[model samples]
Target chain A: MKLYNYFRSSASFRVRIALELKGLRYEYAPVHLARGDHKLPDYAAVSATALVPTLELDGGERLGQSMAIIEYLDETHPEPPLLPSDALGRARVRALAQLVSCDIHPLNNLRVLKYLVRELKVEEEAKNTWYRHWVREGLQAYERELAQLPPSTYSYGPTPSLADCCLVPQVFNGQRFNVDFSGLPRTMAAFDACMKLPAFQQAQPSNCPDNEA
Target chain B: MKLYNYFRSSASFRVRIALELKGLRYEYAPVHLARGDHKLPDYAAVSATALVPTLELDGGERLGQSMAIIEYLDETHPEPPLLPSDALGRARVRALAQLVSCDIHPLNNLRVLKYLVRELKVEEEAKNTWYRHWVREGLQAYERELAQLPPSTYSYGPTPSLADCCLVPQVFNGQRFNVDFSGLPRTMAAFDACMKLPAFQQAQPSNCPDNEA
Candidate 1:
């Protein structure tokens, strides 16, 4: 398996975490989002959508979407299942993941931020305000949900699961963008627990091949 | 089963389509978004994040997030599966679904639009421009991925799957928002095909419990 990755893309960060959690050995083919390699014809051929973190299976099937790719990995390699065994639990975990992945991350994502700054003529401070707004709203709700979880060391359970996989990255992105974590103790606590794990540490943006810093 | 829904919520629309596809009977429990019913304590008890399309199963399980509910429906129902038979195909279908669900719809969702209008002080026209811009970028890429398939009537094969479930609601939102579609022939063509189906037609917002002329 090979993953087309970009160091700072939160979506790519998600797939990397999933791969690390599953103990999957795959070559990392850095797509260099900063250099616009993802927009090039060569990379575009493999991933028609021009998105990074496209996972190419050994059988030459390419899968897009970080959630879908992570799901495929979980299904194919089920040792430490990323999803809960029960259907309802699975749904809960997915909802938690989507809270970060769907509602929060995309709002503050690099491309969307670029569009806000470049296209909409949003001032830098206003763009930062936009980013922080999503993080503040989303993290407040997330803190509430995490607080409801039976006092787990992690987001869902004691062990890292798909929810943690998503939470850690969003927290990383939130912190990276200077989103205030003052009111989100549960979220910050869970994120601290997740960061202690080898898998989480292994999947950081700095750990990726394309990362310069 | 009962569904906490809003007619114009694309997330809610996806679940309705999934329920109809599964031939599952569900009581319509509309949460009026314009009236701010979703923010009430009762509805928030059903959904922590205060989003629509929370599926309360017959077994007393409450599932939030439309994709999570759709997957749960597929897992429990099993007949005429929403996902493809193979993992790769399932990944493909899910990636396409998330391309809309995760990437597109969330950016242009009612809540986000409300945020733009209320908090950001974006004018109505600029809000529409914001909505249309994300739709065009997402659908353009959606059209690119769809072109890889055998030119089927739906987003995937002839039958409506998860991709179609997400696509129709998005198209509904797009058209309702007046997002221009002259650039996306394949998408419009596929959406047209899906809309002809009774299941899709039945799931339309105009057919929902809270829909008003």
Candidate 2:
């Protein structure tokens, strides 16, 4: 499998973590979004939506959307389950994942912030304000949910599931923007614990081939 | 089961389609998002995130997030399966669903749009531009995928599964905004066919209890 990824993309970061967690070997094909490489014709053919983190397979299968790609990998290799076994438990994990993936992260993606500055003519400080507002609101809800778990170490259970995959990347992005995770003690705690694992630590944006910094 | 819903919310509409498709019996508990009803104490207790369409099971199990709730319903009641039996097929269907759920719809949701116009001081034309920009991009991908299918009346196959559940709401919202559907004839055809089904027809926002206008 070949994953067309961008280093700073939280969506791609989440996929890398999932792949690492599942112990799958894949080639990384970095598409630098910051450099407009993702918009090139060659990369555009692999992904119709023109988004980074497109997973192309050995058998000519191409997949997009980080959550969908993660689920695909989970289905193909079930060793480290992306989801829980039980129905309700699976729902909880998925809801937690979506809370960040769908609700929070999408609002603060690089493209969105760029749109605020370019299209909407918003100032730089206002753009960061917008990012922090959604991040804070989202982390507040996440902290509320995470603090209620029996153990505050992980998002849901002992093993890192979908929630942790989303949390680690989101926290990384949060820190990049200086969103101040100081208030989200439970969320920061879980994120810290998840990053200690090899899979999570190795999937950091800095570890990617296209890391600008 | 009791579904905490708002009639016009696309997320809640998706759950209604799933429940109606599965022939599940449940009481409707409406949460009016426009009137600050969802911010009330009782609703806050059920969903810490204060989002609509939280499914409360008969056994007192509470669930949040639309896709997760739909997955739970599918798992518990397997007669009309929402996901494909095969993993790749499931991934494709989910990708199609997420194209709208994650990418297009969230940006145009009432709260997000409200934030743009209110907090960011983006003009109405810019907000509408933002909405159509995403909807057009998403529908282009959706149309391509729909065309990839073997000329079926539906998005994937004959039966309306996960993809159709997502397609109908987005198309409805898209049409409401006067977005052009001519380019997406494949998706338009599938949307037309899905609306004929009782499950899809009944799940229309106008069919709900508190459906205004």
Tell me the alpha-carbon RMSD of every candidate.
1.6, 1.3
Worst 10 residues of 2 chain A by lDDT: A144-153
Inter-residue clash pairs, candidate 1? none
Each prediction's DockQ against the real complex? 0.78, 0.80
lDDT of 2 by residue, A1-213 (tens): 899998899989989999999988889998878878887899867887788788988898888888889989887899888788899889988888988988898888877878888888999999898888888899998987776567745788888888888888888888888997777887888888898899987889888777877
CAPRI verdict on model 2?
Answer: medium
Quote each prediction's TM-score. 0.96, 0.97
**What tens digits encode model 1's per-residue C-alpha lDDT throughout B1-213?**
999999988899999999888888999999999899999999888878888888888887777888988998999898779998887778889999999988898888778888777776778888888899999889999998988877787788877899989998998888888888887877898899988888889989899868995
> How far off is each candidate at the interface, as Cα RMSD in Å?
1.1, 1.1
Error of 1 at B191 (Å): 1.7
Candidate 2, RMSD to the unseen true structure: 1.3
Candidate 2: residue B152 lDDT (0-100): 79
Clashing pairs in 2: none
Docking model 1 quality class: medium
